[model samples]
Target: MNLATHAALLGWIPVVLLLFASLPPRRALVAALVGGWLFLPVAGYDVTGYHDKHMVLSAGMLAGAVAFAPGRLAAFRPRLVDLPMTIWCAWPFVSSLANGLGAYEGGAAVLFNTARWGVPWLLGRTLLADRGGVRALAVGVLTGALVYVPLCLWEIRMSPQLHAALYGFHQHAFDQTVRWGGTFRPMVFMHHGLMVALWMAVGSILAVALWTRRTLRDVGGIGMPWIAVALVGTTVLTKSTGAVVLLAVGASVLLLADGARVRALLIVLALAAPAYMAVRLTGEAPRTAVLDAAARVASPVRLASLRFRLANEEQLAAKALERPITGWGRYGRWIAYDDQGRAATPDGFWVIALGQFGLVGLAAITAATVLPVVRLAVRLRRRRAAAPGAGPAVALGVVLALFAVDSLFNAMTNPVYFVAGGALAGVDVRSLVRRRRPAAAQGRAPAPVVVAGAALASPAGSAR
Candidate 1:
């Protein structure tokens, strides 16, 4: 994934897109922002030891700084959701220091680590700060992945040469691109073909969510139904069972419940993934029955992989327990070893988080992501009232939960996840503000507040 500086400087293409995106009817900016994230080369130009798409993030951070500068202070105001996120961001420094690595080295590592989640989270909070913004973010993701569909089709035929052709190096192992039936899987510009499948899964779910709410026209056009099907087609082509499973899960939730309930379900799911990991790590869960069920449903190959991951996670969890509080910290410290002292990388992101940051760090990150959906779901259910951004919030929350669980299987380092999370954070905070408005503010009676504005709540005070 390393793009040489000359090739990496080309990363500015999407940041440059912001110029035209600013001319938007809003979708324009979303397209630019998301296009920048999805299309940009990953691991472009290292800062310290961690190399990722630094230029892409710089584009977002640059935009946020300018947008919130000077007279625009209120737009930058913090909400209850920010508290855990703030902790999430700051705790890395604590963990880094605890690593007992040289202070300077630990500090440097922490800076780039912050970029992994912090920067994109900030982009959503600032750039797309409203329901329109949230919708735009979702559509932007759809379109961004849509843009990849053609590229994916190309790779399916030609194999994944796009990154090497464009950036002068392939992003992943050549053998991994060769799939079950000997067909080539599309990697596009992502770290792995699985990552491509994951993004397509997110896009498919997002498109269907938009179509259900009829906001597809706002972002894509009347042809969005077809577009959704096409995205689903791409997901199937990915040959990654996880993508297919998530698509069914997302669509079923959308069909059965309103956005609030969907979000509440997401809260439960968010908690459950880690909880299972906790149980599995302790060997306290019914391992035999779980594997038997997975064997019954999953192909033998897939079930074997799952069992292997569970076994590895158990080993890593035991090692992590030795330094339960602050965790093993950077380098190869978080990795586990056998009696022969051979090291193994923990396969799950949650496992890695547990081994590296311990429970404190894990809880902080999990809460940072989950609480926004929880807050929105509660607000949506309690007053039995529509909430601002609930439609987009629900869709985004679904992606959030799907991705969170997927992270247990995959690292979930895709910047778009953070962008969605930050947008949900903004949506949650904004809904809270609108709900808590003073009677004086609500008493003014502003245009009936548009009752059917697709989950934008009317002021309770406006009621008879």
Candidate 2:
């Protein structure tokens, strides 16, 4: 890490405070989270322990929220849907202790996981469960993508030099920057080009959703149609085949499916990761067939990359199976080593979670991320097709499910998706239930449901 990287990381704390002071708590959280993820250095200082810039920024956001939005924090109530995340955050401690790594290490793991994963979920549940919160988040990410268009175009032509130019270091392997035929893949400040591409893809999904619902006219004064085109064009240019596929799948669903069909598709997508894990573990995965299919569509280089990842996954999964319950604990214990002292790298997040904490940890993390989407789907099913905020809610939920699917191949961790998940998990299901009841039976107008003595704002398009 360079001096500039140090300054950028340390400066983010005050920036968070400034954001909270200048913007509403919800927008502040979005700005701090989304903007920090975009521009902050990928490295951070070790004041007491090794903290990624992500966890450090998350801590700053949590502190800002507590200091400025105490009422919102105090108003948060834990639901059963939140239990999986609680477990996911704390599971590493149990695995640490099980591996005889002692309570000290175990406790540290808990803190890291909580900061990295739990804080954003809490933020979502507390500040972003409302109609206004939904709009802020969706539009915030859409706007962020628009902001990245120029940066991505810059990296595509000049070869991803911004992180190096600004932060004083390259974030990842230089070789990975160049894609097919020496085309540059923009890493921006993220860990990998694929991550940046996926971020753009997610923004595209939200743009399509907001436009389809007629909920958003403009994001930062750029019309939604133009915003959608920019995001979609950038996503394609990123040269990440997986990200393009994700954008395509998301756009197709938002454009073609009804609410019920959307919910059903989300449920299926939610189950995809766990299903792949089961098949991979049982050796029932049709690997050759899949590769053969890919070979026809994927470039030769891409096919070779997929083949290599599958080969490595086989070894890593087998090692993880050896431990079964609480797999080999951290510090590369779960990773297999060859006679030459080379470590087998686990590419997919699913296998890494399995190896690190075994099936218990895998299930916990998967449920934490996946169940919220499933819960939202079920709740939305009970709602009328025209329920306020239903369009963006469903669109955001689809992005969350796609994140789970993406985790099957890449270990890119974005807290924005968790924020979306928490927002979905925090949806006011009771309001939907009450709205379903007949107005005549209630002996009055079907008034909007009030929580804490305040009527929740209806989302856009309701003419409220």
Poorest 10 consecutive residues of model 2 by lDDT? 449-458
lDDT against the true structure, each candidate: 0.66, 0.80
Can you list the residue pairs that collide in candidate 1? none
User: Roughly what TM-score does model 2 have, to 2 decimal places?
Assistant: 0.90
Given candidate 1, what's the lDDT at residue 106?
57
* lDDT of residue 8 for candidate 2: 76
Tens-place lDDT per residue, model 1, 1-464, is: 34453554554544445443444323434544565556566555444423566445545444544543323324577887877767766666677778776667556656655666776677677666675567556656766767778888889888999888877788789898988776798998788888899889888887777667654442222266777888899999988988789888887887676645665676676676767767776677765767888888899889988888777777888888887777877677889888898776576787788788777777777777776666656556533323433555677878887777787877756777776777777764444325355446756642221111111112231111
lDDT of 2 by residue, 212-256 (tens): 877766654467788889899999999998999999998998888
Weakest ten-residue segment in model 1 by summed lDDT: 448-457
**Per-residue error at 73 for model 2, in Å?**
1.8
Top TM-score: which candidate number?
A: 2
lDDT at position 330, candidate 1: 69
